[model samples]
Target: MERDRGRYVPGGRESAHQADYLELFFDLVLVFALNGLVNRIVPALTTDDLNVRWAALFQTVVLALPLLWLWTTTGHITSRFDPRRRLIQLVVLISALGLLIMGTSLPYAFSGRGLAFALPYVLLQAGRPLLFIFTLPVGDAVRALYLRSAIWFAGSAVLWIGGALTTEWRRVVLWTSAVAVDLIGARLNWPVRGLARLPASAWAVERGRHLPERYQQLLLIALGETVLALGISYTNEPATTETTIGLLTAYLTTVLLWRVYYHRSGEMLGEALDSVRGRNNLGRITGAAHIVMVFGIVATAIGYKLVQQHALDRPFPLWVVVILGGPALFLWGRIRLERVVFDRLSRRRVVAIVALAVLMVPLAFTSALVAAIAASVVLFGVAAADARRSAGRPPEAPAPPA
Candidate 1:
């Protein structure tokens, strides 16, 4: 493939390292693994069993740490190194294997399955950082970034191993601390040198087309996971007319959320991140913002599952509130990130946020299903307005090749 050198422009092409297909595939695997774990856990939530909820939550938190860490590091590395290289391929494959092990350990992380889960996760968490520390050449600033990152990874590995050997609650606490430290440390350290300095060549390697493509693909994976959650819930229940409508509403809400993300603000946000002075700020804005967005997505998916289960039978006022309100939070982050508010709030989004809030009052007195449907409609409206507004403006053009 002829390299499009133009795609290497600063603030225009930092995303160049993202491998869309590979990222999508990786996310797909993660979704399946997560879904498997969720399937095991959701039943406990429905039963109102506190023990089950705690166990499931512990498992989810433990399993999520390594996967998210890997995801963040993978994008960072891929942005810096050419994915087409043989050495990079080997590293990615090894990382993938580690991720697979982490994903598989979800259900067992906190339960009687402790050893089964913790061991592989230890391997996965430690593998990439170790590999990058040793294999990547010195002198390059990127090497320094990895070396710093490896410090956090090593700390996390110690906690993981310590957690694995401990009693139940202590295990959760240890692993949580490990993940928390890694997360906070990365924010404090990793992007400091290269991203802060913003050398044109390094910036080109970090923010070009590949990175944006990876971000876009990952967002899709998140949306797809939401859809999958909805499908699973809808299929398991007895399908009635109300259930069908509720399912459709939930699905439409997901679609609208996806539209708002991809159509309205994704590219512009990418451009903005690229234009930022340091890779550190870019990493903070793009990398950190996406993590927040994904959390909202995961919350929305959980909300969707709740909606599908209750939409026909016993939709609670809270369920209605969460389903509609969740997307608003997601879009709010996007709007904040884009700095596009006050330009013109889409009539639909305004309605969605307001309508959902308004409906919640009546929902307190009436049917849960009524509240859910209203909230869904309002969210869809908000997403549509945002999408239209984004579509109207042209994305910032890519800069000239350096």
Candidate 2:
């Protein structure tokens, strides 16, 4: 079969070019900005004022949806389109601006000023898909994917716009429904004109390094944001020796988590993904692993906040359990993907689980900050050791050329 050069160029060596570090750096800036805004707003939700609490929750979900969408969309586009292109850079710039607007509008969205937030967000949300649709010379199959994506974006925009017009709970419901529609459409394999069919070729040989690097970088930014939140919280509170140690422990935990992930697992997953021959499984695994990783990170952030709030006033054993458990869950989730232990328990994973269980006891007795950080490190350390042991063995050659 002849390769279509115009739509699909082949023979690009899957070299491990260093990830576009600059792109990631810019993304981190946006992430930190947004995180700062969220840290400011979320605490109000727990305040004694019921109105503030309700308003905070409303604004948080409203802002969070667009932020999540932007990250996911940019990561997807960057994976497929060459970020070095002028057009792509412009789209990224617009998205960044949209993020800035979204960040600024968070405190105001629930006070019937949502349109101020929603309009820019819609622009950011719509711009990337539209740009990619017109610019990237993708084949019919991939174009179909974009079209479906566009429909989802349109639906989401409608809900977002509607939410801005009215502060009623119904608008929130509508926006949520729109998000659901997009999610379900993708899950159900709903087709769009010109791009419903999944192209095995587009993804099969496409560079895995690019996408995985984006994933890793985003995770790092999320961790950094959490640490920033911890710092701010610690500074505002009375600084005691315990608080100081807790703060340092929180930072160490974040560092150890990074070391374990990058050192032990990231490269292995990248190599495994690159070696795969088709796009479907690789995309699914990549997507799933990423979700689990981010979920864990977000959970850790929440845990960090909880630890900071409770460190001086209350015993936070449960919060401690959560912070430590968050990363353990993340690591275990990754291990499940790596070892293909979908339905059955693998020996190594069982051992990892047992290690986690052992850590839980200490976690129950320590400060939330200490326990959470210690647990994350322990989980990462176990996984790293396991990965190293596996790496040392020689590969068995293909059996005598069959």
Candidate 3:
């Protein structure tokens, strides 16, 4: 076994890493999973019942966090390990399968397929680390890290499986608590009373480009969801004038989302990671910011479906929320990303966010198409501002903490 060291896991972060083909394939699974998430929410938004609408909205957060966490954990694994190794490739493939199962079970998760969701999730969360524990050498820092993580997952498994057994709000409570445990445990380095926590070196990036590239791929996946929703909705019926314009509006919004994100901080993220001190902390912050942006993009995709289905019809308050709120959420996330990378917020993003919020007052009374177009206009302003800011200047460099 001593001879096998560095065969699976890298000996150190001695080289810059690029994303592997397997990692990209795993992200493709997320494309389907996120589309399912949007599909689940659209129906609830269309209904007149406020309770069901709000419940679906709550469900969005509940379901999305776990799926995103799976993706995040996978990214971390591939970042730290030699993803080309056969064993690590198996891990990525299995995670993709787990995500597919969870996505398929998502629409019915609160209903009959609760266990289907919980079981795969539990297996992935607990199983991955257990596999690594045996393979990694004794006294390896990563081995201890996995040991602590497995302990945390074991404690959460009870809640996840128990949540599947119960019905109604009980399941919701249990599952939500389970997710909280996983997230909080990771945030705290998966601590155990008797074991040593991860060393500071665990957070350092050997391949600085790898993790950030994975995150960028995630944001692109989210943007792709918006396009998929538009294409699917447009084809469901004839291309009427309203639907045509709605599709265009949604596309424009998607473009702006990509532009706003990548214009400065997003494009410079790799450099930011390479130059920043506390790379681990920055990585966590970067992950969180991308999560928020992805959620916003998902909401916007839901809004696109709503717009296409009822282009001329007056939107419900929740529909209005989806249309305007989505871009606002993305802006907020971009703001956080900006702070970490540039150490400052973009004035354009702040103004765009405020504009979206104020539009909600008028948008609530307008058609869904109108609300979507209005939201797109605000995003366009931000994009245009980005262009103007960078028109003659050189690209911005990351100003992350030393």
Supply the TM-score for candidate 1: 0.79
What RMSD does model 1 have? 6.0
Number of the top candidate by TM-score? 3
lDDT of 3: 0.87
User: What are the lDDT figures for the candidates, one per model?
Assistant: 0.60, 0.60, 0.87
Model 3 earns a TM-score of 0.96
**Cα lDDT tens digits for candidate 1, 125-243:** 55655665555444444556556666556777788778888888899888788778777776666444444422322123264556656666767777788888878888888888867
**Candidate 2 or 1, higher lDDT:** 1
lDDT of 2 by residue, 3-83 (tens): 453332212223434456547756865666557455755467346676765555454554565566567666666566566
Provide TM-scores for the models.
0.79, 0.76, 0.96
Candidate 2 to truth, TM: 0.76
Candidate 3 lDDT over 1-402, as tens digits, reads: 123555344333334288888888998899999999998988888888999999999988999999999998888888887677677788899999999999999899999999988899999999999988877777878889999999999999999999999996999999999999998988888888999865633234545588888889999989987898889999996899999999888888898899999987998889888885567787778888999999999989999999999999998888888889999999999999998788886788899888998889888887999999999989988988889878988776678866
Candidate 1 or 3, higher lDDT? 3
